[model samples]
Each structure stands twice: as C-alpha cells, then as structure tokens.
Target: METLRHIVLFVHLIGFAVLFGAWAVQAFGGKREFTRLMSIGMSIAAVAGLVLAAPWGLPDGAEMNYAKIGTKLVILLVIGALLGIGTARQKRGEKIAPAVFWLVGILTATNAGIAAIW
Candidate 1:
C-alpha cells in the first residue's frame, strides 16, 4: 500500500508536468487556447490525486490533511474551468484575456506551492 501511494504520487507529479509544462509553453508562445493534451493531463492528475487520497478514507489509522487537499482541489478546478473558457473563446474566434492566461498559469503553479508549502 505504501508503494502504491508513492506510485500514485509520482503519477500525480507527472500529470502536473504534462499539464503545466504544456501550458507554460503555449502561454509563453502566445497561444491562448488550452491544448487537448493539457486537458488529458489535467484529468489524469485530478483522478490520480483522488486515488492517492483513497487510503486516507479508510477507517483505520490513516490520517490526511483534508483542508490542504480541498484547497488544492479548488485550485485545480479553477484552472480547468479557466482553460475550458479560454478554449471556448478560441473556438468562437475570440481572444482570451491575458489575465486569464496568467491566472490559470499561476493557479496551476499554486498546486505545487500547496504541495511544498501548505
């Protein structure tokens, strides 16, 4: 079980890389829309995060930081929604605001901050 937790955490990290890495590249390159790959990576990270928390849900000696996790979840959702909105705007031939890109980029980085500093 311990090994499984570590594996899932690693995957979560990988997902973060895929999602944020892609975002960073696109945002820096002046691309506004969310890539399909980024969405896929975000989905993977979100699911793996929940799975990694499964053991803590057990009625045993397991303990977890629900507050931190909840905060992280909200951040992740905001990033997803922002990306979705940006994608919609792109599809409509509208430009996504620069602030939206910055917000999503910073919020995505905030997950790492939450993990390290929370």
Candidate 2:
C-alpha cells in the first residue's frame, strides 16, 4: 500500500506534466486535440490520485490541506470549462485566443504545484 501511494503520487506528477504540456502546446498554436486530451486526462488523473491517497489510518481531514486542495480543484474546474469552450468552438472551426489557453494552462500548472508542495 505504501508503495502504491508513492506510485500514485508519481503518476499524479506525470499527469500534471501532461496536462501542462498539452495546454502549453495549444497556447502556442497547437491543435485543439491537445487541449481536449489534457482536460480529460488531468481530470481522470486527479480523481485517481484522490482515490490512491485515500483515508487510510489518518483521521478524516487530518492529512488534507483543504485550502490548497480547494484551490487546485477550482483551477482544474476552470480548465475543464476552457476545454469545453474550446471543443465547442473547434466544432465550428473557430480559432480560440492563445491568451485563454495560456491563462488556463498557467493557472492549472500553478495549482498542481501548490497541491504538491503546500
């Protein structure tokens, strides 16, 4: 179980990289698929991480830093929204602003760092 936790943590970090890299690519004029995959992958990875970091032995809420976790959740949600918007626009062949991608990417990546460190 201890090893599993560490593995999950590592995967969580990889997920963050994938999420950030995909978003950054889109922000820098990459394809919409990158943004789509990032959003979906990040969301799934987060859920898996939470499951792996389960309530084993620790009292409820004791191991959690809710403030940071909440911030991370919010940022992730915002990224999800951006992904949705990008999808809708892409369906119509519209070009989304790079600034939007940059904002979402930077914010989400920062949130991931905060969750890991803070």
- Highest TM-score scorer: 1
List, residue by residue over 6-92, the lDDT tens digit for candidate 1: 888899999988998888888777465678878878988999988976754344676788899899999989988988998898889
Question: How much does each candidate deviate from the true structure in C-alpha RMSD?
Answer: 2.3, 3.1
Weakest lDDT window of 10 consecutive positions for candidate 2: 52-61
What's the true lDDT of residue 74 in model 2?
79
> Model 2: number of clashes?
0
**TM-scores of all candidate predictions against the true structure:** 0.89, 0.77
User: Clash totals for all models, in order?
Assistant: 0, 0
